[model samples]
Target: MVFVALLGTGTAVAGQVRGPAVVPLPPQPALPQLPWLPPLPPVPSISVQALPPFDVEPLDLDLESIGDSAQEAVLQSLQALGTLRESASVSVLGSLQDGFAFRFSQQQPPRDRTEARAEALYRSARESIDRGRYENAIQELDRLIDLPGTSRVDAALYWKSYTQAKLGQRAEALTTLADLEKRFANSRWLKDAKALEVEIRQASGQAVSPDSQNDEELKLLALRGLIQSDPDRAVPMIERLLDGNSSVKVQENALFVLSQSQSARALEIIAKTARGAVNPDVQLRAIRYLGAIGGPENRQVLDEVYRGSNDAALKRAILRAFMTGGDRARLLALAKSETSPELRAQAIQQLGVLHATTELADLYRNESSAEMKKRVLQAMLVGGDADRLIELAKSEKDVELRRAAIQNLGLMAAGRTGEALKQLYSSDASADIRREVINALFVQQNAGVLVDAARAEKDPAMKKEIVAKLSLLRSKEASDYLLELLK
Candidate 1:
């Protein structure tokens, strides 16, 4: 079967061809298109202009201070594996609140006393909170929170919420809209607050939806509005929808929208949803959610699911989750252990797409099953291991796997992958697999081999099909073979 590579940019995305590339069935599945998410209230946009403007002065961070153990960990974590990992990390880093305050005082009357004084004050306020110092903590937090949209906003909200909740003003805090809501109702966060209020109630075993919003439409509309207004707030609502009486649509929308909310809170809820989802749709959506909000935690959840799941589709979905999470190790491990040879092969193919070589290379080299190892080689090509893929096709045992590997060797039009296809042209094996090799060899642009195969072929039908294919990818070789056949 001819292997179809769904090349994105230039990466292979699928598997081993049997003979003729197995054409996919027609009829694309349709689902309901999602409604537009409600607009989120604007987040507190801190002006970078407030900070000292950049100069030629290089920004020096004391990377050494983080300790030696972190160095190796950081490197592995920051692997340049050409996955969307770098982009995902960039997205995550872009979202962190600027919690740090570079307290610059030109009038540093005493350098020694400044840190100590601030430390003392910070400590005193923190300790006061422990000792029923709500007012003191509030006072200190006020100054900290006021420093032009500081990272302490979450803390500020917490303190404000806590003080109000503690002082028997729980209803008010519950009903309270953030200042962002009052000042900028059009912003993303306002919608989040409305959604969050319902979620908070649900988490507390209080009624989650408004008394009037008993209908699914009303609840869904409210949720859609939430992610638009306040992703932070909407996240809780989405989680609650997952857990509550909401339909799968509401839950899916919440999950989908929260994935974009891109806050720690959103990530936290998505993790919980992935772990706790009973509905497969909910669980699968959870995978996409984790991918959208990728991290070690998200990776761990997918890995756990893959390890625990027996369903092939779910396993495939979980494999997809790992790709999104950028957990190569977990993905390869799952691939190796998958009971379904198809899933295992798919995992290997995906690694090829990722251009990850070593993860499956050695494991595949030692694979005992001919059919299985072939699957690995197919996977490797998809993953972008052109050089190794070429080598494996040359050295591989298990004739079936070797032939399968040969077919994909030229995945990236790696002209080199086809060299093996040259040798395979003469092999006396299944005509189907051999016919497949004809197409795979096209990567190396070997028209002559295909021409010879077509003319010298013993199977009339297989020869006809190969001739048709060889002509389709390019006409010269097949036409040459056709001319030779006519003689």
Candidate 2:
């Protein structure tokens, strides 16, 4: 038992030197709170009369550890900041030792503080803001802004934008952002600055601008002007505006202008936007504009919109398309289901205007509204249904609508409705309808009217004007009337 097993005999026992050994030690003292890194700007150009004649107000908190009172943070922050002012040394020292220990400790005295240490603190503020530590960072960066020769040019501009944005000085933020983007484009803060600039531009463009001085207004004006002079440029700008910041109305205006460009991509984007488009007015406008740019390709792309949805204005847009590519049977099918009375009537009238025949007469015959039926009958005259036009002129009760039908019938029938026109020109109750009949009669045979007009003219200009009207009529009557006028 006394013979301890020398198990370590094979290895070097105690004489071998080891490389290093881990050791436990007492905790190192934490570093004391240092002065702000750089000195602040000399107290502002105030005449020094603005400040209190006495020392700073007595601290409402204890001078031991940082107080827990509501005033502690503001008190400590102010005391810490006061170090930047050399004249405030005695007052700051009193705040630290006697009334309130706003800093980390009461043991540290003002005389013992290092300005270099203060510079470090100021630098920490800038670094904090750069890292987006807004609450803690603003005060620190503000202190640093006073420091000379550190040339925190880009940092200063950035923190200005950041703090102003936090303080809701959006115009100021935008100004600072623009300056940073311009003067400090190469700085690390430039990307964020550019972002803020975009926000302001997009914001002002999309909605109301702040009633700031001339410069901010100028910036917004320049961007909006770009929208008109260069839509391609404008469109890209609006795209970037959508990135992170835009009011809803701003977004809609951007989409609206882009939609109007009629670019293919713009159309697709508009269609997609239509799904979530917040304002129904903007959405319907987009759809109607698409219809106005009508073509087979246009309609095909908008086919679902035409067939599925029931926005009245949008449906009117689709129905209006039949003005060119009319499928009367299809229109008739859609007509029964169509809810809008106005559009239904327009569709009905367009039918007569495009391809009206006596067989479709039933559609117009049963139409009760004299105003609308007159539109149908007028469409018939234009649509080559001359006999139908004459029939309406003979029987229609609304004097003006009937006169329009009769006048158009005379033109289409080429003297076949002459008797009807003569009656309208001579006896229609309405003065306008009589004038319309006179114009139509001239269209039928201008020489007689031209002679009468020239005979009735009291002024030289009137005589010349009547002859000019006859010349355009290009009738036998016009030639005779012109010959008589020359005589």
Candidate 3:
């Protein structure tokens, strides 16, 4: 039966193997069949219509048709946007006024009316005296003396006396000098007062010979008179004094007298003394005199002395003379070819004083030595060559040289320098370079750029450094940034 069942079912029963009999199973319940359902209807065939392409036209927004309030709002929004853009640009580029406008204002406290009047009177009196308008000077001096609490009273009195003496009113001058002595016993003008008294008394027929006088000051006065009276005679006397073992004061006075003379002999004597023919002290003085009395001849003398002498001190003096004589060509030649770095640097410095910006830029380009380049950079700075400095700061490959250029840019006033520093801070990746830029901006008091940089900086330490710099600033931009930080 189990075999018949297995054949009918086409299955093998567990435990029905040949060695074991199958246990009789309990009666199984009949299987229930599920109800049959019809097939789903064919899916509906829907077609999508292809529409023609529509052109998107711009809206014709007629602002005139809008309500007044709406139009006003739009205008305000545009203006605000414009202002924001302009402010952003200004922060980055710095203001035109900062660069072009006069930055300096009168910081001196306003003088009170009384003080002002006194000063005006004193100044006018001195100017009048200088112009040989003794009467006008006397008038101004009297007014100054009459002013209450005038500090220039002593000065006015001394000048009034001098003016009187110049005007040949010797008696009136002596009386004025006496008044000065009585009023200000411990005054600095007392020495001048005594000298004036002697001068006035001498003019009053008490003629004292300059040669007999032991006073160096009196001798100098007499020498001045002699030079004015007879320059030819004074030149020989000055040469004798310079050549002799006279005191340096006497020699310097003689040199000064010689400088005032336009005579050829005077020039020759000055040239000789400047050539170290005299004492070292006198030679140095003569070199200075040559600079003060600048001319083609004086410059030639200076050049000859510079080449002939190996003395560093004298060469340096000649360099100064070259500047004073306005011999830029000579200075440039020395700055370019001088073997002594010290003297070359000195020549470059003198060029700076002469505001030789073009020459300095040329020198910087041709220079190979780092130290010499730095000196040239300094000279450029002194010459106010901001454009060149900006160029170097941007393109110089030497890290230290670039840093130097950046540092010099900081010392300059705001405007282009501030803009260049902002750009450097934005583009440079070197932490050290960026740090230098930050320092430069701080030096320029350019808080606007500093604030902008701080906003854009990602490094925490760098940002902190920028913030620290901001804290020291007193600008509106810096204050606003700090307030924003608090919020």
Winning candidate number (lDDT): 3
Question: How well does each candidate superpose onto the true structure, as a TM-score?
Answer: 0.47, 0.34, 0.56
> lDDT of all the models against the reference?
0.52, 0.49, 0.68
**Which one wins by lDDT: 1 or 3?**
3
Task: Give the per-residue lDDT digits (tens) of candidate 1, residues 38-68.
Answer: 8732322111111111010111222234443
Q: Which is better, 1 or 3, measured by TM-score?
A: 3
Model 2 residue 160 distance off true place after TM-score fit, in angstroms: 31
lDDT of 3 by residue, 1-487 (tens): 0000001114566785466667999999998998889763232211101100000111112343455444334333322322222234322212221112111112112233354456557656755754567799899899889887666688788888877877789999999988999998976567657766776787788876463223544555666778878998877877776765443445666688778888888888998999875555468779987887888888988989999988665787788777767789999999998998768877987676577788888888898998788777766665567888899989999988888788667667666578888999999989888988887776667899999999999999999888877876679999899999999
Least lDDT summed over 10 consecutive residues: which range in candidate 2?
46-55
Candidates' RMSD to native = 27.5, 37.5, 41.3
Misplaced by over 4 Å in model 3 are 1-216
